[model samples]
Target: MIVCHCNSISDRDILSAVEWMRAADPQTIITPGKVYHALGKRPECGGCLSLFIGTMEKSDSLGVPAVLQNLRPRRGRFAGK
Candidate 1:
């Protein structure tokens, strides 16, 4: 299915790009922009963002690497205190 009409990006394109990125760098965080870059395209209208993200979520390689998980400090009333 076509996720981003402006960029002609498909579900497969996003999935493939995600897998390729994971293979290239297991610790790298995958984002919509990264996926677009990997496919050699850029987002245009921003209408397909939600769907694009949904498609990306379907990929097994989209999760943050184990080593990089929970590395950020919590942000709440007392997060930085």
Candidate 2:
């Protein structure tokens, strides 16, 4: 299951990267760039973004960590700014 043709990334590779990152740092935010770096590759053309994101979303470890969750300053907090 090739997720990113430009980077030659597979679905398994993405999941492995996600799990490795989650295990390494529970608070770290996982993104496509991080995954590419973990796999020693880089994205090209941006053609695989949709599929890449789709694959990443399938992994349970892809979610934001509990400790790092809900820190965003929404409407009320932003009103003062």
Which structure among the candidates has the greatest TM-score? 1
CA shift of 56, model 1, Å: 0.3
- The window of 10 residues in a row where model 2 has the poorest summed lDDT is 72-81
Leading candidate by lDDT: 1
Clashing pairs in 1: none
Q: Please give, for residues 1-81, the per-residue lDDT of candidate 1 as tens digits.
A: 988999889999999999999999999999999999999998899999999999999999999899987787889895875
Evaluated at residue 36, the lDDT of candidate 2 is 94
Q: Could you give candidate 2's per-residue lDDT for residues 1-81 as a string of tens digits?
A: 998888789999999999999999988999999999999998889999988999999999999889876577567756556
Clashing pairs in 2: none
Candidate 2: residue 70 Cα off by (Å): 1.9
**Per-prediction TM-score, please?**
0.87, 0.86
Regions more than 4 Å wrong, model 1: 72-81
State candidate 1's TM-score. 0.87
TM-score for candidate 2: 0.86
lDDT of each: 0.93, 0.91
